[model samples]
Target: MNRTLTERARSMRIHSGLPKQFWAEAVNTTSYLINRGPSVPLKHRIPEEVWIGKEVNLSWLKVFGCIAYVHIRVFKYKNGSNSVLVVKKDDYDKCNTEKPIMKMDDGDSVFKFDRSGPFFFISGNKDNSQKDQKLIVVVLAIRNHNKFPPVAVPPAPVGQTPASSPSPTKSSPSPAPATTPSPISHTTSATSLSPI
Candidate 1:
């Protein structure tokens, strides 16, 4: 049946009065097939195999372009907790926008937004000292919360001993070195305590 239909289609190529409606339908089908091919390839393409290591996880799944909230630093002047801000993806489209605020869901914290806003993108987690930089910048959604509190800087690395005032000399002698006691052997019988 398909071969017969193909022969008829070939014969119809030479025929001049093939219905105008049929010609229009054929063109429409060809155009539709061409336009649909790219999207079909996208849907049918095999996803790259992802082998997660023991340390990596793939549990959380959120829709792209969905709203999310991120926590920001506490306000400097106000003595209160920081707030959550709404972040969206569309805000990070511009190139010149630096210091964009981004909201991250690292599983430990859940940010709640009071109002909807664009994500303020932050720089990626790459070390800035390296010469070949292809760092991914992260955009953060910062709420109107207070600016982050100053982090307590760690103390300087230990080197010098702290100076102490010299104590008066004492005449007491030093004690002898202590000796370890030998392990004692126990009998097989269990002991019970009696209450009065």
Candidate 2:
């Protein structure tokens, strides 16, 4: 047990960089874990479980010394938490845009919008398919009122704008494939230019 405690402390010093103030905690936690293991002298019963006469649930155990990526700090927009996904116009056409705000059922992102305007248009998750699919941007959703939702950004590598097929009525500079500008977020769910 002395050897084990010394080895654990050395390992923690080598990698964990935990302060010496927590050496007692390290020794205690290690002792508790060791006590939970099946002991040959105790007829293979875990020392900690022998008192309770129940099987110890080891599921809560984690790597003793490990590095975990809990979160990546960056620009808020780039973090992808509340990201505005920008996809190519060609890719945008594939969306079932009639309703884009999807409901997450059991962690599966399911399309649920009938008309439009539900609360959130969060990032897409895998439906039943095993393949990963690109998430649709929220800007394309048809708003319930006359006002437009957020702007649609084109999914081009940074510093470039994706150029759409030119309308004959207007001539616009083509954004290079390598350089795509943020596409206009406005997409109308226009029925007709009819008088109310």
Candidate 3:
């Protein structure tokens, strides 16, 4: 049994193209597979099935060295009044009017973060009109451990009133409250958007 395990482990490691450092994992996987496979000495019965008196679940099994991805679901506030754009670091720094990585027309779209990186969000109108542009820059830094920095809201856009503008003498009608939607889930590849 020991010789069989050693040989199977070596074969598995070589087939998977894994480094020698993964010998322990290879050995473990070999032992698991051996237990789940039919044994000639046991009348072609599976060892684990005989021991547990039940069939083992193999639905979750995957290739030993295959690439994997993570699924992410992001919940964004519903704001139909303005258009939101997600741009790369260089584009945001230069304020270039080129095509953005993502554009939220209805403001309720989901953005998946499949890997560790930074995402820059700027809210404004769809058109390039200066008057309709209300730049609200927000930076969301996602790391390997899922740590996120405090959301930083940049200063107001040029030629715009500062946040400390005085209140109007006459009362104005309050805008409609924004609604929150249910969480949406998706799976996507990692993007190259990261902080400078």
Output the number of the lDDT-best candidate. 3
- Screening candidate 2 with a backbone cut-off below 3 angstroms (N, C-alpha, C), the clashing residue pairs are 86-155, 151-185, 152-185, 160-179, 160-180, 160-181, 161-179, 161-180, 161-181, 162-180
Q: By TM-score, who's the top model here?
A: 3
Model 1 worst lDDT window (10 residues): 187-196
Q: Score candidate 2 by TM-score against the native.
A: 0.30
lDDT of 1: 0.33
Worst 10 residues of 3 by lDDT: 187-196
**Ranked candidates, highest TM-score first:** 3, 2, 1
RMSD of each: 32.9, 28.3, 29.4
Clashes (N, CA, C under 3 Å) per candidate: 16, 10, 0
Candidate 3 wrongly placed segments (more than 4 Å)? 70-196
Model 3 residue pairs with clashes: none
Give per-residue lDDT, candidate 2, residue 95.
31
Give per-residue CA lDDT, model 2, range 1-196, as digits (tens). Answer: 7977766655543344444444554566677777888889999989988888888898988554443333222212323323322234443445322334332333322343232111233233323111333433221122123233567655899887787896686667668678565454544442321111
* TM-scores vs. true structure, each candidate: 0.18, 0.30, 0.36
Q: Which wins on TM-score, candidate 1 or candidate 2? A: 2
